[model samples]
Each structure stands twice: as structure tokens, then as C-alpha cells.
Target: AQSVAQPEDQVNVAEGNPLTVKCTYSVSGNPYLFWYVQYPNRGLQFLLKYITGDNLVKGSYGFEAEFNKSQTSFHLKKPSALVSDSALYFCAVRDKNAGNYQLIWGAGTKLIIKP
Candidate 1:
């Protein structure tokens, strides 16, 4: 079984400052991790993925994440925060051992950027 954990319920950052949203996962084998963002009344939007390769992966809206296998962490990062970047962030993991292909979603973290 694979699972994702988002320890933070909310992350507050000032505009133009760097922001990060923490995530951790547990899996049997290698984990397939992903990050998504959701706005009010909108569906989750794909941000980035870590299937393999580089530890650092970049994604939409100037977001990037570091895939730390040893720590079982995939923390999302932004060089600079924006007021528009305030949204709900989710971390998800794919269970390779599961028969059905479904993502185990994390409890979302609300990112609040103050100007």
C-alpha cells in the first residue's frame, strides 16, 4: 500500500518570498509521486511528477520539487511566491502493488501568500 502525508494544513508566505509545501510518502517499492494545485471551485491541476531520473523536477507556474528518496519526501518549492499562487496543494502517490491504478491522495495544504 502507498500513502501520502501533508503535514501542513496551511502555509503562509509573503509575496516575492520563496515558498515550500511539505510532503512525504510511504510505499512498498519505488514510489510514483506527484503534486497538484486546486483553486476555488476548480479541479486539481497537474503540477509535476517524480517517476525517475533527476531529484529536482520542474513544473507549471514556476514550481519545482525535490525528490528525496532517503527521506521519502517530495517537497514542492517556488523561487518566489505570488498572491495568485495561493491555492490548495495536494501530494499524491501511485501504489504499484495495487491492482487498480489509483492515486492515494494527501489531505490538501492551503497556501496563503500575503502581499
Candidate 2:
């Protein structure tokens, strides 16, 4: 079975400070990891994906993630945090079952940035 975990329910940071949201996954063969941000009324916005190559993948909104295959982790990082960046983040992995591919998402992690 494939699973993803966002250990923290919330990540708090100050404006202009670096922010990170941790994520880890377990799956057989190669894994396809992804990060997404959720906003009210708006659907999940694609951030970045780690399919192959580059251990470090950069995404929208000045966000990037480090993919560590040995550790089975893909942690999101932003150098400068902004108040407007506060939102619920999700980590997902693709799982292929019975010829169909589906995304297995994490519970979520709410990011809070204060001035």
C-alpha cells in the first residue's frame, strides 16, 4: 500500500522568515510526489511535482521542495514567508491500482505566517 504523511497539523512562521512543511511517503517501485495549496472556494492548486530527476524541485509562489528518496520524504520550503501565503497545504502521491492511477493525499497542514 502507498501512503503519505504530513506530521504537523500546523506550521507557524513569522513574515520574512523561512517556512517549511514536512511530508513523507511510502510506496513500492518509483513514487510520484506532489504538493498543493488549498484556498477557500478555490480547488487545489498544483504547486510542484517530483516525478524523476532533480532532487530539488521548485514550484509556484517561490516555493520549493526537497525530494529524498532514501528517507522517503518531500518537504516544502520557502525562503521568505508572507502573510498572504498562509493556507492549507497538502502532500500527495500517485498510486496505480487496477490500471487506474489515483492520488493519495495527506490530511493537510495549515501554515500560519504572522507579521
Q: Give the candidate number with the greatest lDDT.
A: 1
TM-score of each: 0.96, 0.94
Which candidate has the top score in TM-score? 1
Taking the tens digit of each residue's C-alpha lDDT, what string does model 1 give over 48-108?
9999999999999999999999999999999999999999999999867776678899999
Worst 10 residues of 2 by lDDT: 94-103
Q: For model 1, give the 10-residue run with minimal summed lDDT.
A: 94-103
As a whole number from 0 to 100, the lDDT of residue 48 in candidate 1 is 98
| Model 2 residue 63 CA deviation in Å | 0.4
TM-score of 1: 0.96
Instruction: Supply the global lDDT for candidate 1.
Output: 0.95
What lDDT score is found at residue 7 in candidate 2?
100
Candidate 1, residue 87: Cα displacement in angstroms equals 0.3
Flag regions of model 2 displaced more than 4 Å: 96-99
- All-Cα superposition RMSD per candidate: 0.9, 1.4
